[model samples]
Target: MAKSGPNYKVNGKEYYRVSLEIGRDATGKRKTKFFTGKTKKEANQKKQEYINKQILGLKDTKTLWFAQTFNSWLFEVVKMSDIKPTTFARYEGLYRNYINDSPLACISIDKIEPMSIQRYYNDLFKKQKKSSSQISYLNKFIRKFFNYCVDCGYIVNNPCSGNKISLPKEKRSEAIAKKVEIFTDDELNKMLNSDDCKIKYISLFSLATGMRRGEVIALKESDIDIKHNEIHIRRTIATTAIFDENNIKTKQTIVQEPKTKNSIRDIPLPNSLKSIIKKAKLIRNEEKFKAGESYSTKNLDYLFLSERGNFINAGNLDKTWAKFLKNIDIPHKKFHTLRHTYATKQFENDIPLKTVSTLLGHGDIGITADIYTHVLKKQKEKSVDILEII
Candidate 1:
């Protein structure tokens, strides 16, 4: 509570004391520091020095350790932002896996340079054998972190501010990537009829609606309206690394909003599908009663459940799908192939591009266009046929 003051000594000498609020200690108690000087000016000067020391000390605490700064940004900035959990997890993963152990991690933020970062990336590609896309993701994280650094005034400018990272141009083999997998009609019917398909209804839902697996699992019974024959696209469920009670990161299933605004849509369900859903609801009644108090099903009237009457862990989907494929004597293909199959069927059925885009919840028509290039290529051939080209 005491303020700065100058005390006149008996010897006609002037001495001053300034109370510096150094904030609290580990406990909730307040801590204060006093600076004594031979003169008032000296006291003021000492107080200023203490203030700067405290500030620089904090700056060092954050900027000196790259991992600490990364976490600070994660908690203060990224987590507070509107980014999705998967996206936040992805950034965290990139930092932990690639950048955290880099030589740059030990250096102060202000001291890091474009060249140092560039060389770091180059080494990752050469020694670590990082792919272009993976390098690109790491570059993106660095850029975001450096931008945060600039915002915090740790650096005057972002070392990552210049030209966008130029990853090595991928060869055609890599750049082109693999064509999307689409299940044929025969394959779809085979899977549907196979008793070994544990997630048969899930596969059918995707094929009928072109919904993502995560989106389908996130659906609650409340989302389905049998009267209107409509299903609301609201949330998505994903299993990713999440921090536990003791701050230990662990893998868990998290339900969150859809990927994009357009992803939240309503689609009319076919009558047969509606009948199937009614039957499913009846089955879930028994599951809920069986699970009883142990059932962790909250307000979420989830359509699908494991044999244990719990939210289906989509993470196990790959292994489950593998078993299903083996049992059905089918070649290996991803579950997402069903979604592609749906989209392809829609386009092939002469559904308008925009209609298909909206139905698939694509952010833009271009994404639908890119994925269904087969439809466009066929249309081009039809154009040539119209002219009867020589």
Candidate 2:
């Protein structure tokens, strides 16, 4: 994720920006590293020196504000890393939207206390209307940064070190009301068979394999094994952060590796999707030969393409999903619900939790355990336990 370069303005003034990734954040989230200077050599040199200072535990000038410290640390983490662009984008958005303008960002780094941070989390949830998950990321950053300060000998103790700080718990009523969004088997059959179903192959493939939207779209002919009835999850296509010659940021199409270690898996194709897959293959081959030299994908083998032969983007896919839902007269839900639908179906059919987790490519088995096994947790309170609850 690191970029180093010099660029010019319209008037021909040149400046340089270099990014270096320093470390991970508290929740093991990736950090952002950014540095800019008037000269290319200076910027690059400063990036190296900054890395060295962290490695050697060098003393600072003692003038670091809370915001300044956070920014500096983020700059290092965002640079020169193997983390995904979507991940970097999330970290950047979290910092800019939630942390940068908070009261916590305005103080001296060493002066921050636990109560102040707790109050900030409360404000973020109660006043700012941020989700509990968002507050948790802020807390993660605060705790990670202060822990680093302690390691650097800048503070005697980390204010965010204790076990007392916790994220907002979901209300019992809200938890009860929250429903797992999924299409029933009957609904799925109707939707797939509907005359108005667009992107039929992709929709069916998602139901069969539980691939994410990005993974499904990024599919290439080379990734599929028609003979073996399986597909390899190697890469994903999405709109991600891209840096330009002028060191500014913009969103552009990117094809990158999968998310986690287990995310890169070989999923067996279900018998139900075989016909759809072959139909898609035939259409693509016909399109390729009909257009001949004019075919944009002649040199490539991507299975899905737009009318113009470009990769089908996520926005258009969602639009197609919406259109299909409208034409089928069904309530709209995220396409991700297909993955959930697959998992729920597997659980209902009595598949093992570990097997489900593996099929879903979850990094942690505990995630599968929590989402699929509703009764595994929350036993009746001991004081009010009822015999023969079943």
Q: Per-residue alpha-carbon lDDT of model 2 for 228-308, expressed as tens digits?
A: 988899988887776553437897777888888899898887887777767877767776777777778542677776655
Estimated TM-score per prediction? 0.74, 0.75
Q: Estimate the TM-score for candidate 2.
A: 0.75
Summing lDDT over every window of 10 consecutive residues in candidate 1, give the lowest-scoring window: 54-63
Off by over 4 Å in 2: 1-62, 147-156, 196-198, 244-247, 286-294, 375-390
Q: Write the per-residue lDDT of candidate 1 for residues 88-163, one digit (tens) a residue.
A: 7888787778767878878767667788888888888888878777887777788888887766656667777768
Per-model CA lDDT versus the true structure: 0.75, 0.74
Best by lDDT: 1
Pairs clashing within candidate 1: 221-301
- For model 2, the local distance difference test gives 0.74
